[model samples]
Target: MITLDLIGIGSGNPDHVTAQAAKAMDRADLILVPLKGEDKADLAGLRYRIIESCVTNPATHVQGFDLPVRDPATPDYLARVSDWHDAIALAWEAAIRPHLRPEVPLKVALLVWGDPSLYDSSLRIAERLAKRLPLTLRVTPGITAIQALCAAHAIPLNGLGAPVTITTGRALRETGWPAGSDTVVILLDAGGAFGTLDPTGISIWWGAYVGMEEEILISGPLAEVASQILETRSSARAAHGWIMDIYLMRREPALP
Candidate 1:
């Protein structure tokens, strides 16, 4: 049987790696890291650094594999994503099978960013693998980008007795603010979706590279800092060649 541990390493910060995740890494016979190409090489490097810091077991082996890119020509969003995930699962199996020996039980670990239960698809991809292999899956939860964003801004996640909506940038842009939710946390925004809404009564707490050394934060009335955020985000993406950011917005008159 193959024991697959999906360990969440937190949002780009080594300090955020949980004790349980570290222990799993130390126990694993092999760890797989995905390289998302040159534009995001730092992401793979961070995973390697985390493994180096956490795994003291000399018997543990680390391997890297190239991740598959989603085909944009597929047109249907869900279909494209499904194809991409299947490809990823295939890549995982190809990278893992050569290293496994039938003589002994094997444990393989994949370090995931943030909690697997959140927007991450690692668990889904792992599920696909389980259908094809004798696999037992385990998860070790880590801090999410939402938690990091709130902690960095020193703010409560929601107003008293109020509902908070957690969603993607595309949803906010296409559907506008969700009904009955005064507080919204936006993630995976490839574009500044907040720009589509009127900034009049909204206050934004935004951060890029949230817990990393290159972290950038800008918070204020959306009307006041919206342009600044766009400029900053653009400049940072240009400098680093990639970026991951999240933000929280709350309308005024929040419960005291």
Candidate 2:
């Protein structure tokens, strides 16, 4: 049996790691890190740095495994993601099985970018692995990009008891703005989803690489800064080969 601890390390900053998360890392028998290709090698490097800072137990083994690229040829979005998750699960088993002992229960940990309960999919991948291995899963909460974005911009998440909507870039591009929630937080934007919106009477707070040394923040009327964000995002991605960003949008008449 494997006691799988999926610890949320938070957006690229070692200081964002909670005490609870550090303790979990220190106690792990083995830690698995995913290598996401050279384009996003910085993400993997950050995980290694965090592990170095927290994993005091010399017995804790660290392992890196290549992440399988999703099949872009798969037409249906849902089908593509499902197939990708399946491949990742297989990759995980191949990485961990070598160190497993039939007689002993293993404590394996993976450092997640943000809270797994949020937009992240590590939890879902773990579920697939559980089907093949005897596993007990535990999640350690850490600051999410939403929290980090708001913190970076020094703004409240919601407007006076109003609800908040959290969605991915694909959904925001396809569905338009959701009703009811005045504040919307967007993640996993491959590009500018905001370009699809009307940008009327809307304000945006945007952050890229929040909590990291390369962090950038831009906030203003969506109408005013949309072009700026698109330009900046392109330049940053070109410079680093990859970029991760999150942004919040709300109706005008700014909340107090």
Candidate 3:
């Protein structure tokens, strides 16, 4: 049996790590860090920095493994994702099994980016592993990108006494913005999902590389800033090789 501690490391900032997450890192026998290829090497490096900052125990070993890419050839998106998760589960099991002992429980940890519940596959991958292994899992929450976005821009997440709908860029493109809600937050956007929406009368607060040193923020009526955001996003992504961004939108009437 293995004890898995899944800790949310927040975005790219080491300070976002919780005290519990820091303690978990010191307690784990093995910490697995996934390498998201050369374009996103900064991600792996950020995790290393977090470990270096929080962990002082030299006994706990950290290991890095190449992440398996999802097969683009799989015609069905849902099926393709299922297959990809299975592959990751296999890799995770292989990485930790050799270090496990039959008599003593092994502590294996994965540092997840942002909150594990939002736009993250670590929870899903962990569920897949549960079916094959007898494991006890513990989750330590950290600041989410949404919170970071709001904090960086100094704006409230929702309208006064109103609900905020949180959805992905893919959903915004497919279903349009949800009805009956004045505020919405979009995450995991590839680029320019705002162009798909009705820019008129809508206000947007967009942040790229939020909570990091390279952070950029833009705000205005969507109509005025949409083009600027699109161009800036493209240029930023090209220059940095990758970008992680999120945005908040609210209809007119100015939430107070």
Candidate 4:
């Protein structure tokens, strides 16, 4: 039987890793890190640094494998994502099976970005692996970019008992702002999806690289800072080769 632990390492900051996640990493016989090509090499490097900093167990081995790319031509978003996840599961199996030995206990781990429960798909991929072999799965939670964003700004997630809607940039762009939500938190934005919404009566808090030293934050009325954010995001991505960001938009209540 193989024990698989999907540990959340939080954002790019090593300090965001939880004690439980660190312990799990130390306990694993093998830690698998996925390389997502040159554009995202820093992501894999961050995982390596976390392992180097936290894993004290000399017995644990670290391995890197190339992640599979999703098929862009599939047209259907859900189908494309599902197919990509299936490919990733196959890749995990191919990488993991070689390290397993007969008649010996094995514990393998994958360091995931943010908490697995959030928008991450590590848990789903692990489920696919579990179906193919005798595998026990465990997950250790870590801070999400949302938490880091809020922390960096020192702001409460929700305002005065109002409901907060968490969604993706695609949803925001496609559907516009959700009804009855005083605040909306967006993730996985390819670019400036906020431009789709009218900036009137809305306040936006935006951050790129929320927890790391290269973090940038901008906030105010959406109308004033929308263009500034687009410019900043473009420059930051150019400087860092990549950027991970999240933003929250709050719509003020109508005056009676």
Name the lDDT of candidate 2. 0.93
**How much does candidate 1 score in TM-score?**
0.97
Location of the lowest summed lDDT over 10 successive residues in candidate 4: 247-256
Tens digits of per-residue lDDT for model 4, 46-116: 89999999999999999999999999999999999999999999999999999878988899999988899
Please state the error at residue 74 of candidate 3 in Å. 1.6
What is the lDDT of every predicted structure here? Answer: 0.95, 0.93, 0.90, 0.93
Reference-based TM-score of each model: 0.97, 0.97, 0.96, 0.98
Residue 149 lDDT in candidate 4: 91
Distance from true position, residue 108, model 1, in Å? 0.6
TM-score of 2: 0.97
Ranking by lDDT: 1, 2, 4, 3
Per-residue lDDT of candidate 1, residues 62-108 (tens digit): 99999999999999889999999999999999999998787788999
Instruction: Supply the global lDDT for candidate 3.
Output: 0.90
Model 3, poorest ten-residue lDDT window?
Answer: 247-256
Between 1 and 4, whose lDDT is larger? 1
